[model samples]
Target: MASLGIVLHASLICIVLLTFFSGTASRNIANEILQRLEMVEKLNFDLKKENSNLKLEMIDIKGELKDIVNEMKVWMKSRHSQGNNKMNESNSDLQKENIKIKLEMAELRDQMDNVVRENCEMKKKWNELDDILISVYIHLNKSKPEIQSGIMPEHRTPLSYQHVAENRKANSVRSVQRIVPPAPDVTEQPVAFYAYMDSYHTPGLPIHTTLIFDTVQLNDGHGYSKHDGVFIAPRTGVYVFHWTIQTEVHSWESIEIVVNGSPIGCAASDTLRINDYGTGSGLVATRVNTGDLVFLRTHESISGYLLSNHRLRSSFSGWLLYS
Candidate 1:
């Protein structure tokens, strides 16, 4: 009974050990399968993500293609429009060229016709002139030679008549010569002091006198004198006096002068001073009337002073335009 009991206990112990080992192996197998299933699930999730991304990229590509197609259509339409415009322009230009050519041809034809007409007219005129010239020549050739010689028949003249005619012609020529006055001497007034008295003056006016001095002699100290001034009645008139003073020095002051007292005409003074020794002029213009006196005043004192080759000349000429 003791040996049997020992066998039974050992048997029970061995079965319990076997059962525990089998359960451990089964647990390991189950864990390995579960790990493989988890890996597969992760791979599927990654594939789904990749597929979604690819779909989005495809949509973008399709949109770009649509834009390219639209742009192509627009470019084609523009090209077609441009082609139509070019064709119309070409047709219009051709019409204009044709019209211009026709107009030019018409103008040329008109010019040719005008030239032909003028040529005919000129030829006709030339022929008529030629005929006239021929007739004139023939007529001149037929003229009498004796008449051309200026001779007359004796019956046309008497000796006494001829003598009287000649005498009358001589008398007529002499009469014509007498009627025509001789030319007044224009030779410059004698180179000397010329004086005119008021005796030849008009009434109610101071005697107007003109004195022309050929030259002023500084050596003689003869220039302006108090009494030299002219007296004219008081009246309104344009008075002009010109005095030309010539000197050897170009830079001389107060060479020519004129002075007027009360009721004097417009008074003017002119002086010419050049840096070079040449011709210079001085002028004075004044309006004066009756009882007015004008005189020449000398400003410079020089011993060698003498009127230039032209000589010192003083002239007073004026008329009373109004009283």
Candidate 2:
């Protein structure tokens, strides 16, 4: 019985030991499970943190892309504006050049017009000169025929009754009658008298005097003295007159008669002074018309006595007189 009891006690001790060991094992297993849980939670937290950082990197990249796009747009707009400006400047330059060319063309046209006008005026003057030369040539040619004809006679002679009688005596009456008179004589009265006297000298005679010109009057026989020193013509025709004068000394004295400021006749004496009286007498028969004023004029100082002789003459010679 004692042995059985001891065996039971030992078995109880073994059982207790086994139970302690089981408890220790169970404790270790629980500890291991708790550690494994802790590790899992840490790994989960790490994964979540890495995911958030990746999301932040993606947002920054998107912002940078937006800025690049905006910059490119601004650059393009500036380029476009520059291009438009260049085009406008080119157009303005072209317009200015065109206007300048037009002005130059207008000036050239004006110059051409002036040149053409001058040429036409010169042509007209040349034509007028040519016409004048042609007229002069025609006049000279017409006169050639008259100069060739022998209708004119030679020698100058007076055609009067006394001249005819003398010619009849020289040649026979038949020959004298066959010869025609050179000029025809007509009876003419004095219309106006023109007298000229030399300058007055202390002891000299007058240079010239008119005899018939002083004696004849317009209505009847009336003589004119030195006081009435002028004569006016009443009618228009040729008149005859004679002049005579005596000088005691020789001198360069001249007398001139002018009508309408034109000299018609003049007498001059160029002789030395002498104690005896010297006479210088002449007859001037001139054809004077109406409206002619006659006066006396002298060239040098002279003074003396004047005497005129009555003589009849013809005034058929050519003399210009104003009417």
Candidate 3:
């Protein structure tokens, strides 16, 4: 019975030790499980935070993409506007060029028409002049033969000249003129005139006055007007004019040849003693058109009175040199 009791005690102590070790192992395992659970919860929270940050980054990228799209649209719109403007400018330039070309062509046509018209008129005048020359030449040719013959029928006298031969005695020679030479034609010559101051007396004004050529002693073809004291040219030509003035003693005289109230030349003279005369003369040759005026005027220095006697103290002479 004692042996049996000891064995039972030993078995009870083993059971107690086994129970202690098992409890200790179970507590360690429980602590390990709590630490692993804490690790997992922290990881989940970090993952959620990372996911929120990624969403924010994606939103920023989307905003940047939208801005890029807007900028590209604006750039494309600007390019389109620029292209339209350039095309419009080119079209406008072409239109202006077309208008300029049309204007130039119209002007050219007008100038060509003027040239053609002028040429036609000139040709007509040339043809008329040629016809006149040919007619004159033909008429001269027809009369040339008759004029060359000495015994012409048109030139013979009605009564024959045989009686003059019977009346002629020996050694008595008679001069018989069969043909009379025609006198030269003087009508085509230019008209000329020489006039003298008829009424030469004291000047009415205090100063010198215009020299009035009252009497035209030699007015050929009435070219000079006596009342107006002017010489009116009949045709365009070169004319020579002269004027002379004579003043009494103790006085000075001056004269000028004037054209249309403008003096072209002047002459001056002064007397030295009493009863003496001062002579002033002026001569001019000028080209004048038809209806030009020419006259002589007394200068301002010519005072008192002018002298006119048998010698014709004051005289004006003019002649047309050419036409």
Candidate 4:
């Protein structure tokens, strides 16, 4: 009975040890599961925050884009209205001048007709006078020897008639000439200009660099300089500046528009897949003094290899609002 009791006790102890080990393992597994749940919740919260930030940024971007579109539409309408007004005024003046020219031409034509008629009548009178002088000369010649033997042929009345006919011809010829004044010179239309420019892409850009655009498609009035990424304000006014950047797969970048060494705005993009693309852009309007400096900067997070410089990929643009 004593031996049986010892064996029973040993079996009981083995069973107890097995049970305790199992219990500890189960508790450890439960603790590990709870820790995993908490970590997943934290990750979810962070993702939610990032998503919220992205949504807000998208909303602000949409608002800004809408505002810019509206402003451009309004500006275009005003310019078109002004052009139409100027064109209308010019057309009115041209029509008035044309009407005046037609009137003057009509008056000139009437004067010319009168001159022609006067000339024809004077010629007819001169011919008639010449015929009468000829007849009188013939009659006087027939009686010159009997009526007045002292009268010379040079002193005959035909000579005076001839002079009178020549004078009438000269007067008619002089009256036929008319002088017309020249038309006024027409002025050319001026070219319309707006302060705007666009730049794109750069190769071999160092890490965490102030992106200096080397190529320029358009720069009016020398506002943007390709030498440095700095945009010099030509006038004291509100100006809008915009920029875009592209990143390689599994890469990210933060772009900021800095005015006079201070950041005005930022936009960032991230891509998680290999060989994929991420693009971002930002716009800002700031009141700037003349000669103020402005440029785009790449944040330190994207200080690695930058995959930019494609057709219209990474771009910068600026324009003045009012001066």
Candidate 5:
């Protein structure tokens, strides 16, 4: 009976031990599950925070993109407007240039037409002048025989007019002798020269400056030098020298005819009105010895252009009256 009681006590002890161990294992398992749930909750809270931050960043990015788009549109519009304005301005400038060219062309055409008309008129005038010259030449030939013959038929007049008729006849003969040139002689050399300036002389000529006449029309005795614009007397005789000077409008000049360093004649040309050119002439008849120097010079300081052109000329001429 004692062995049986001992076995019951052991079994009771084993039962209590097993119940305590089971209770401890269940409590440990419950604590582990609660820890796992807490960790998952913490992870979910962190994810939510990260999502909110990402949304805020996206909002900021969207605002920046809108600003960039608006700026690009404004820039594009400004560039297009500027290009159109530049094109318009360039077109206007080109049009203005074209108009100016057209105007210039029109002016050139008008000038050409006017020149053509003037040329036609000049041709007609030249023909008329030729006719006049032909008539004069014919008349001169007809009168040559009469001039050579010294016979004059006496007209029948009343006794009271006899002395008057004689005087008139004598005067006519004398006038004829003066007008006609003497027949050419082998021994005698005719002395004559004529020259004109080729172009306008510059203003402000110095005092005592020799005026050059470079365009020689005639130099029969070969006494005129184009290099120095001086004529050296070829023979001792009486000489008649004449000179003409032209000055521009609103200007004045004084010139002199010089012979052997002495002033033989003085002339002045002055113009006070616009387009009114001035011309002055001087004439001198004096005895000139062989090798005497004759020229034209500025008498005083000049004040304007000394004009010499096709229409107006400054000329010097000289001829021997007798030698």
Candidate 6:
């Protein structure tokens, strides 16, 4: 019984010790699990904080990217606008150049037309001159026989000359007629005039009123009237006319040469520059009938003094080019 009791006591002690060890081990495992849970929670919290920080940084980066995109858009827009403006300017310049070229081409065409007309006129004049030369040759050939015979033709004597010869001694009259040559050829008289403004013409000359050249330098054919400043065409002919105007400082004047109430030429003098004198001249050629009136008149309202002096004289001159 003692041996059995000892065996049971040993077994009881082993069981108690095993139970305490088991309890202690369970407590340690529970504590270790709690520590592991706390560590895991801390790690999760740190990860979450890091994630939040990363999110904030990503948001900031996104905002910066958006601002950069907006700035790039603005810069690109400005560049596009500048390019468009340059293109518009180039287009305008091209348009201006095109217009200028068109005008130049028109002028060239006008010059060509004038040249063609002048060539045709020259050809006509040459044909007429050839006809006149042929006629003159024929006339000379017909007069050759009479010239060789050395006899005066009957047609050469005037009726009054023949009567006078009959009343006088025939020999003496014949001798006098032989000594005298045929009458000289008569030539057409030339028509020309030149005049100047001898006095000052103040401002406010009425529009369309005639401007009188008070001094006459030349008045051949007596067609120019200095008092009235008019030229009456002496004969039917083509005439050339020229006029000059002078203006004082800061003055403006306009004039036109008129033929029978029709404007033929015009000129203007503007001396708006400081202490400057302005001068203008006009020239025209036109056909006029006998007794047609030609004069100078104001084209527009005069604004300043019309200066005429020894150095600079406003003058009018005209001449018959052909009849």
> In every candidate, how many clashes are there?
12, 14, 0, 0, 0, 0
Candidate 1 local Cα displacement, residue 116, angstroms: 2.8
Superposed model 3: Cα runs more than 4 Å off: 1-189, 204-208, 272-275
- Residue 199 error, candidate 6, Å: 2.4
Candidate 4 lDDT trough over 10 residues, lowest sum = 174-183
lDDT of every model, 2 decimals? 0.39, 0.44, 0.62, 0.58, 0.70, 0.70
Give one digit per residue, the lDDT tens place, for model 3 in 1-323.
Answer: 44345446545655655666677765566555556555765776688889999999999999999999999999999999999999999999999999999999999999999999997786566446534543443344234443233232243333211233232222122232222111123337456888776756664222223455666778664556544355755556788998888777777767777665457888877775566767888888999654456766555545656777676567888988876
Please, what's the RMSD in Å of model 5? Answer: 19.5
Give per-model CA RMSD: 28.8, 31.9, 25.8, 46.0, 19.5, 21.0
Candidate 5 lDDT, 1-323, residue by residue in tens: 44345546555655665666677765565555556555755777788899999999999999999999999999999999999999999999999999999999999999999998997786566446534543443345235553234232243232221233244334421111111222234148688999898876577775656677878899876667554566866557899999999898878889998776668889999885666989989999999865566888788878878888999999999999997
Q: In model 6, where do residues sit more than 4 Å from their true spots?
A: 1-187
| Residue-wise C-alpha lDDT for candidate 1, range 120-160, written one tens digit per residue | 78646644653453344234323435323433233322223
Q: Sum up the clashes in candidate 5.
A: 0
Mind giving the per-residue lDDT tens digits that candidate 6 earns over 1-323?
Answer: 44355546655655665666676775566556556655766777798899999999999999999999999999999999999999999999999999999999999999999998997786566446534543443344234443334343343333231243243322221212111111122136778889997766466564654677878898766667654566766557899999999998898889999876668889998887668989989999999865566888788878878788888899999988988
User: What's the residue-level lDDT of 86 in candidate 4?
Assistant: 100
Better of 2 and 6 by lDDT: 6
Candidate 2: worst 10 consecutive residues by lDDT? 174-183
Q: Whole-model lDDT for model 3 versus the true structure?
A: 0.62
Model 2: per-residue Cα lDDT at residue 295:
39
Candidate 2 lDDT at 87 equals 90
User: Worst lDDT window (10 residues) for model 5?
Assistant: 172-181
Badly placed stretches (over 4 Å) of model 1 are 1-33, 142-323
TM-score of 1: 0.33
Query: Global CA lDDT of candidate 1, please?
Result: 0.39
Of candidates 6 and 1, the better by TM-score: 6
